[model samples]
Target: MPSTPLFSTYRQGENRVTSSMLAVFERVGLSVTETILARASGESTLETVVFTNQHSTGKGTVPDARIAADFTYLFEVKTARNAIQDPEQLTGHLQLLDEESGKKTSKRFLFVLTPDPVRPQIVEDLADMRVVWFNFAALHDAITEVLGDALSAPSERDRFLLRELQALFEAEGLISHDDVVVVAAGIAHAEYLENSAYICQPDRFFRPGLTHLGFYAGGAIQPQIARIHTLESRVLFTYAEADLRKTQGRNKARIGEVIRWALDTEVREEGEEYMVFLLSGPEDADTVRLSAPLVNDKVASSGRPWAWTMSQGYTSLVALTRPGVSRTSDLKQA
Candidate 1:
């Protein structure tokens, strides 16, 4: 399926794009105030505010900033899917600012905000100027870092706005911060297991929630409580080796069959590793307890072994856990 664009149709205009840029700057720890919007195609408040000391020039230019007693930023916003049309326009704006300010002590930044990534040549052309190129992904990262605390808080309003911004960022083909957290957590968990599990979604472009996890085991596994510990987080769960034959006879053949099929296919593929988590419950249940096996030497050494495949390629396992429910077998029936 084609992925959804990060920006909506209504927000594709230059003005709306510019407003979004300002919102990001303000939200991302920048002391932005005393703002002005462009009234027409050529008339912008940026030029007026920053060029107060110089004579009027009919050329339309946007100043990166000129917040009184604060800072000056000149921003040019482009929502195009292609490269910038005219690089000289940005340079011209900078020249205009230089003429007006004439070596003033104010800090100036030329910002180019675009939905699409720019070419290397574009960066080279603006190398001498105070230009900073920000595509949607880069900008999203900045906003996420700045608002990390607010995004994690329980405030409904803050979360709502954060989601809106995240949606916008995702629409522009950028991964949301929420997905990043989940993936990062999953990676840390995988690493802590001594590389027993492999992360599925390593690419930042794909969205992998917390449930997308896979593991590797060498032999028959036994039921045990395993804690997936990462640098910053930990998740504890009871793992048990699944009995496919028993599951097949219980009208849960589809899931069992899939797991069996994946195990069989994964073993045949050279150097391929895959794992499966069986989630069994009512379709509408709020939570379901998951059970998977912890493969260890003790379980492998046991003579009466439960045959589970080893090696890995690609597989996904997901099981739901109910609050206050500890045992996997204690999962409530649908």
Candidate 2:
């Protein structure tokens, strides 16, 4: 087990992770730091925030030797999702960033890191350019990708520390979004595959941090999963009801389209309520086909393949990719 005494404190639950992140960025060098910053801010912000201002000479071009620009990145890490609703917390952070306007700060950003799969409405509605919202799973992916590129270089120490940082995040369960919901998509499988949307009763409880959606059809689980559209934002709509119950998750017009689509598909009847999951668009990369379709092949005492009877089941990405995992029974919840 990897452990560090500097990050073993409880001053703030997320402070340990935040401190560890800064420490790793400081030790691992500029590439990893700039990659994460570029992700949180924007790719075009690389020259403005992370690098020195280049000057043009009379002959050709010249790069500044000393790269010094006061760019500040403040992180607010949340292990849970509820704290994002605190208006005072976000307002205070904005005030802190505003105070730097008079200083020599070329660029400043307040990066909010949460475990939520989707950006909360409160954070999304903030009318500030300094605020950048990102989730932990994305952060892990960005770091892992940058480090992968760095592996070809001679920076062994950098790779070792960064790998430790990745391990620390995993140990804290910040990026462990392997859990998936395998639901029976009987009649609406094609509709969902085409529209990139899924609807169910508002009361249907899915575990927090469920990463993927696996459709079960044709007596076997679908080879692909809606991984890219992993619960982007969910909105609750009551058909034939004038008043909307929860309308802050996604765009109102888009919600209306989904409601109309549900009606066309007969998934929601008149005066019925449904929660529509806004999946990613039907692009080639939106869903991932597994190595092989998971089918019910296990034999029972009666010398026949056991039948799958559940409308829904839980599994993990690890289990889906594991060898010899052919039956739904092998997909134990992680």
Candidate 3:
């Protein structure tokens, strides 16, 4: 059966998957297990924080990748300066995910890759894996309709993104994104095609998934925060490890500075209303590792210092993402 086309990427980090937005999930302070990356990131779930800088998030459950959520679809996100030359990459991603997850939880996994002109083998491999596939060109017209016709120049956030995309393209000597691609494995539904069939996209793409199973209730996560940008919706920075570090370094300190400042200033001050402080690491050890220092810093800054430690192995991470510094209830409710 031919699938209907769906999804449109306007820019690097700007795509909306749902219609009924109770509030922007981007603004809310999202936590996986207990760590607080989002809150530390200025305002919780601020698109500005993620888009402007390379901010890492930890999901309540996921392996290998730190900032991923436990969802129905599992896929690798392959990004390059040149468009994908092979679909076999997805197979490797599957193996990595297998190691990270330790258990094959989903029946499907996918790869929502980028850099235009998709290689045909990418789709051919999908046939081999029984994984449905989608490519960059399919989305080109829709994406262009949203991003290309704009009279104004791209935003500072987007300009940086365009440059990054260009860099990725050039890294492989690709001349243009017109040749980029996004492939999906494990998805019988189309990522940009039929919403009913596909649940998630490569870019950590998500809409409110009430009908979708196994994904977190992101909308219910935080109510106080306001979205400055979208969630992992259409972020430009979506790769893992070195990719994350590279992107962070590009705007790391700047973004970190803001997050640090916010935790010290705002959340730390939100005082004793049973407000949660989330944190997490890869292993019970990693969680302990990041949490110990982070939690201690909050106490010490609050004039009540303490000590701590951590372990190893990081499949995924999540914490309430609280601010490091803390203080007495000097402020009142809003």
Which prediction has the highest TM-score against the true structure? Answer: 2
Instruction: Tell me each candidate's TM-score.
Output: 0.35, 0.58, 0.22
C-alpha RMSD by candidate, in order? 18.6, 8.1, 26.7
**Runs off by more than 4 Å, candidate 3:** 1-68, 71-89, 102-108, 112-119, 128-155, 163-334
The C-alpha local distance difference test score for the whole of candidate 1 amounts to: 0.39
Residue-wise C-alpha lDDT for candidate 3, range 259-279, written one tens digit per residue: 333344442222111111111
Tens-digit per-residue lDDT, 194-272, candidate 2: 6777776665777766656778877778777776343324344445331352354444545666776666666667566
Q: Which lDDT value does model 2 have at 3?
A: 38
Off by over 4 Å in 1: 1-14, 23-29, 32-68, 117-120, 149-160, 172-334
Is 1 or 2 the stronger prediction by lDDT?
Answer: 2
lDDT of 1 by residue, 1-334 (tens): 2233323345456655556545543543222122212111112333323324443345776454443443466777765544466778888878866765655565565666665422334656677546656555555544444345453342455445545765665665433222111122222332323322322312223233332232333331222212222211111111111243344453233333433443454422323332323321222121121354433332245565433333222221211122333322232210
Q: Sum up the clashes in candidate 1.
A: 22
The model with the greatest lDDT is 2
> Sort by TM-score, best first: what order?
2, 1, 3
What's model 3's lDDT at 311? 14
